[model samples]
Target: MPDESKLPISELQPDQIVQAAITSHQPWGITANLIAYESVGASLDVIRRGSEPGVKALAMNLPPVGTTIDLAIGALRSWHYEPWVWVDLTCP
Candidate 1:
């Protein structure tokens, strides 16, 4: 990865904020996956994951994620699998 420590902050607009990767989260257990806005002192996030990349892409593109777009969040497991005989629900 690039040198995050040296990431620039000069281009930020008057009303905008810089996207950041939070390297610290002690008891909470959250990590670098979380993005933050240092100017606004808040973290950025999406409500839910879409079925495909398109819906998610559109959401970010409409307002843009900025130069730090390279830093994106994703799920560890995007899908699930089970044997056909398996059943999550059954008659008592």
Candidate 2:
């Protein structure tokens, strides 16, 4: 497997998905850790214990248009929150 952090857009192949993570975050006022599938799914690991992991997922429905994050990372692909390279790659 390729090192996700070091992987660049130029090295990405067609139809590939990458996994990215943030240790702690409060997206939309909810404190949690984020695991974006980058336009495929958005997995939110709740900060507090006892809460179901990924309580809210983008796979079910997409956020409204023009939302920078939404536009940057599509619904579900955000699994659904990693920074997918091919989705934004500028080929030479």
Candidate 3:
């Protein structure tokens, strides 16, 4: 299997938010609110899966929501599977 840790950061680009409804697992029925950040903060709601193209593309796209003014607040306060792992979600 490919080493996820070795994946080059450059491979990930055009960052955007995706709303993924957890289909399975303990959090089934829950929604995964994902945020992709560049230098500034931007937010979008995922609407449907496979609507886009890419890893995060598997996640559905939704309406553009509030701009993440506070990184710490948005992340820490939101319900995430693993917030620490999310650090890479926004990183380049």
Candidate 4:
């Protein structure tokens, strides 16, 4: 399991942006939150804890934030919150 204490707080850069998703166990059951990453080394804080499942844990690499390169719930199940559908973040 990746340590949440080491999560990074640096702002994301243009090249870092990636199609990402955050999943957690909530009262309704396992849920996923889709998000966009702006950098390779960025941190996504857990704002609120779910009601039922109570968010027992979270897993993601996110550069300096964690050690593991990929987030996984167990031995097999893993989620890649990076390298999703690439898009232009420079245009207004």
Candidate 5:
């Protein structure tokens, strides 16, 4: 594993899998804390494609705060100048 603490957000590449701890519940998804990059925030869209409706429903139920999950880096997005990590649900 790379030195997570020293890894800059800009250095994060797509398709890299990482563990993140869910921090809060969102109506549309969940907000997570990227375990490797403290400065970056992660989000997962529970209703995304590739999963069945039932599976999506289960995911939509939401995990308790602090639940850790494995996710792949889909893309980096900016919101008001802040960087956000969008997890990929398409990859296994």
Candidate 6:
């Protein structure tokens, strides 16, 4: 296995699927700590596969905190001191 702590998001393959543990919920989405990339987290702003633009995704159906789920990489964004990952749900 690769050293997760040293892995960079830029090195990930396109549309790669990864595991992440749910951390918390926000009004916009859920926060999850990634398993393949230690110290890295993803912001699942768009939970559904075909959610329309401007439509709000409901967190009621999302996994609860501590649950590990598979997600597909959407993009890499920088919001603060480090690069943040944006992911899409890989399963229903």
**lDDT of the structure predicted as candidate 4:** 0.29
Candidate 4 segments exceeding 4 Å error? 1-41, 49-54, 59-66, 72-92
TM-score of each: 0.20, 0.22, 0.18, 0.18, 0.66, 0.64
Cα lDDT listed for each candidate: 0.29, 0.29, 0.27, 0.29, 0.64, 0.62
Query: Quick one: best TM-score, which candidate?
Result: 5
Estimate candidate 1's alpha-carbon lDDT, on a 0 to 1 scale. Answer: 0.29
lDDT of 2 by residue, 1-92 (tens): 64454433344344344333322234432211123332222333323221332233442343333232312221222123344422321111
- Return the top candidate by lDDT: 5
Q: What is the per-residue lDDT of model 5 for residues 14-76, given as tens digits with 9 covering 90 to 100?
A: 878777788888666677777767467577766564274533654745668988877667777
RMSD of each: 17.5, 13.5, 12.6, 15.4, 4.5, 4.8
- Residue 6 C-alpha lDDT in model 5: 55
Q: What is the lDDT of residue 35 in candidate 1?
A: 37
Task: List, residue by residue over 1-92, the lDDT tens digit for candidate 1.
Answer: 54455423233333333233444333322123223322212222322333335435534443323323223322222124421111110001
Per-residue lDDT tens digits for candidate 4, residues 1-89, read 64444323233334343333434433332333224332232223333322213232331212232122322221111136553322221
Clashing pairs in 3: 45-62, 46-60, 46-61, 46-62, 47-60, 47-61, 47-62, 48-60, 48-61
lDDT of 3 by residue, 17-73 (tens): 332222222211112333341222222222322233432432332213332222111
